[model samples]
Target: MAHFSYRGRSAAGKEVKGEIEANNLDLAVEALMRQGVIPLKVSAKKQASGLNVDVSSLLNRPIALEPLVIFCRQMYSLTKAGVPLLRAIRGLSQSTTHKLLAQTLDKVHYDLTNGRNFSSALRSHPRVFSELFVSMIAVGESTGRLEEALLQLANYFEQEMETRRRIKSAMRYPIFVLSAIFIALVVLNLKVIPQFSSMFSKFGMDLPLPTKILIGMSNFFVNYWYWMIASMIAFALGMRMWIGTTTGRERWDLWRLKVPIVGDIVNRAQLSRFSRSFSLMLKAGVPLNQSIQLSAEALGNRFLENRLIGMKTAIEAGSSMTVTASNSGVFTPLVQQMIAVGEETGQIDELLLEVADFYDREVDYDLKTLTARIEPILLAIVAGMVLLLALGIFLPMWDMLDIARGA
Candidate 1:
């Protein structure tokens, strides 16, 4: 099917324009008419191609989490307040300032009004709504708890955003300091170091080993800067492509879990997310097996996803939750014990939620300490590099001065 952009009027004489998918313009018009939209004009969506057009450049946009969380909360509120689904979507679509989100919501609303269920409509836009999102909403619709489910979804996304913020904050200082050091080195290599080299040559003084080494480095950097930058970019892109593959993703995630300081935080954060999502699904009355399946899918870590699959298999074979988790080797001993107790107490969902909360706090504290530790280390590294360069340059000049005094 091809997508068509259409201009139309509603039954109440309101002008509306949007995009719809159909076999042809005629079919698109018919679809619009079915939705009480009197189509005045319809045309196939145009494909743009020009010298200035660069489709891949658009891939650099950052994923904004705030708008998505707000959307979930607002949609949940509107639905809870008895607003018809289509009307609520239309209102949200009109109110949204983001073109991409507005277009998505418009299409979703149109689909919903045309007899598609919420989850199916969302499924059509995978770039906007993830598989986990569609699954949760499907469960909600099936159990007649859409409002509650949406609220939980909002909280889930908010927590994810918070986690990302924490990690970014922890890493930001190091990144900034390293970037500054690189810039300073570039300036020194391209400009300052060459002057020192020329002066030393005129003096007919043999430069010390450190000065000689620094000068050689500067020359290489000046000559091969473009190649260096190109290699870095290529490496990054290649790594990203590799990580997009299943086996590569699993290997990378496993490596991340083994990283000294950062790995521990990542592992705990993922566990917290899993615990929270599992608790939410269970509280929503989703069956135990299905909840485990959905929670595993929600984990977003390939290695953990595989472990969850094993746990799912064990459950199918009549193993208890505690035993399945214990066998997985991902859960810590403390977590496993708590889960076992929860199972015995018949309050597994609540206990899992509490565990999630506890881990969330722990993650926050760890991020703070990690940031504190990393800041001083990064600053010290920059300071050490600067001191070395200064010594390399000045020590040669000092030797020349001592020779002059002796002469």
Candidate 2:
């Protein structure tokens, strides 16, 4: 296929110019005509230089979640109000706060003017439009329920962002405390411990075991700080490389699900996403196996995704969704019972939605209690560090005091 830029007069006598992909100029002209355009000129679009293209892309930031959510909500409102798709996109392109999104929507409007469907235009920008999103829009296009689809997408994105916000907010305190502890240890090793060691040496007294260990660690830090930094960088890179591999990531995700308080939060969040996405797909009339496959990706947990993929395979082989979910061992008994009942009553969509709501509530409660649950553990860690510092630094001082008193 070739991309052709064309100038045309629309049915409303408005002049428009845009690019379209087609086999040849004749076909491109035919496409424009089909869209009620009288083509004046058509020529192949000129490609920009590679450097210019690269620089432009580098400067184009990805759209943030809030703006995208607003875009969806606005799009639903506009479409539902009977505004034409092309006009709606053109207006949105002018009004959107995100420059990249605005530019993309402008191009989408151009594509629509050149006879492309909305979903197809969106599909061109894979970096912005996810497969699940594009697929949902495609269904909307086919079923003439584009507004409903947009509403669903808006709600899904909002919920997903809210979950992420809650998790991050809950974790902020622990992260800050851990960072402070790390900095304190570094300062002690690099400065305070050396000073104490020199003073103890002047006393000509034998240091206690804790003081000796602390001095040894201080020496190591003073002499080989470069090696320590290099080791940390290497370990980080190695972990990244390992997680890039499928098997390693699978193992890591599995381990994550076993972590105590954090794991419960992660599990509930993933299950919430799965239930919601699966419910959306089912309501949109997506097939069971396909819905499972898409929901697995949407869940954002490799371990659960693997299991859900296996469940899809099972369903394809004539197993029921309830049985497959139960056998997977990832869900709670309540979820399993709900699925079983949903299947029996053929209200799977409603039940899945309920399951999503239940998990959302669970995650909300977890977020509220997260700091409370973690505070004691953090206090214990702080206490341990303080005790170690006291023993390592102050214990030797007692001997120095005794010797000074005798002198």
Candidate 3:
């Protein structure tokens, strides 16, 4: 299918402008006609040209997740109210002021009109809708309950956003402390230390080791600031490239999951995501094996994905869900026990949702505790650095005073 930008009028003679996906212009018009929209003109969307289309531009693009969540909620509401799918999509698209999102929905509406499945159209833009989202939508479509699925998706994304907001809030103190340290270091090296170096030179007094080291550092920073900045930029670029590679990403993600206080939060967050996604898919009527596959792929963590894949293989071999998941070694004993119980009771989906809720609370608690603990530690480190700099400068002045007294 291809995306077509178009202008048309509805049955009420109201003009509308939007994009849609179709095999061709004729198909596009046909699709619109099914929705009671009379197409006036249609043209295929042009693909971008040149090397400028890269990861940087993609990352720099403004992503309004809140607006997306709102859109999902509103669409779910509209659909639940018995609005026709095409009309619902068009109404939602027309209501949005964001040009990119409006155009995207227009295309999606067009695709839906052309008999393409919702999940398939979503998969075409992986950057916008995630795998978990499309999978759930596919399940919803299969069950003839797309509105319910959209509501669940909106809830999931809202929870994800909250988790991110907590992490960012927790990091704020450390970031502020680090910024202060950098500014203090810059002032000491550029202004304060240089004057002391000049005074020591005129007095012809040999400085202490700490003072001498400080002076040397100050001189180097002053003379080679550009090189330092360039090297920092290069290091950041190299790190980005390295992390973009499969091996590097796996290694880094594994390391991240092993870090001290932060690792616990990360693990809990991932568990919450897995449980939530698995439960949602299952409740939406997706098959067990397919749900596991899609949930694992949605994780974005290779290590966890491999473990889930192993569980999938075991399940296909006739192993029970609880036994297969337990053998994966990634799930906690509590989770494994819950899964076993849920399977025995024939309430796996409900139990999985409970597990997800439990983990979500744990993540919130751990994040709060982590933030409280990290704040003081960061402050202490910054305080120690400042104290060291003060001593390095003031101790020399004290020695000079002692020398003058002796004379």
lDDT winner: 2
Q: Write the per-residue lDDT of candidate 1 for residues 206-294, one digit (tens) a residue.
A: 88888988899998998999999999999999999999987999999899889977898999899899898888888878777767766
Candidate 1: Cα lDDT at 27: 61
Higher-lDDT candidate of 1 and 3: 1
TM-scores vs. true structure, each candidate: 0.82, 0.85, 0.83
After superposition, candidate 3 runs with Cα above 4 Å error = 1-64
Candidate 3 lDDT over 141-240, as tens digits, reads 8889899999998997798788778888877877887898789889988898899789888988878888888989999989999999999999999989
Answer with 1 or 3, whichever has the higher TM-score.
3
Kindly indicate the candidate among 2 and 3 with the higher TM-score: 2
List per-prediction Cα lDDT, in the order shown: 0.83, 0.85, 0.81
Model 2 per-residue lDDT tens digits across residues 1-407: 98999865575444589999999655676688799975655766767755434565668765667887998999999999999898899899998878788888887787789887887677556457765787789899999999999999899899989999999999999999999989998999999999989988987888898898889989999999999999999999999999988898998898888898999899888999999999998898777876787688666578888888888888878899889999999889999999999999999999999999999999999999999999999899999878878998888888778877999
Candidate 1 to truth, TM: 0.82
Kindly report which residue pairs in candidate 3 clash with one another: none
Location of the lowest summed lDDT over 10 successive residues in candidate 2:
49-58
User: What residue runs in model 2 are displaced by over 4 Å at the alpha carbon?
Assistant: 1-62
Candidate numbers, best TM-score first, in rank order: 2, 3, 1
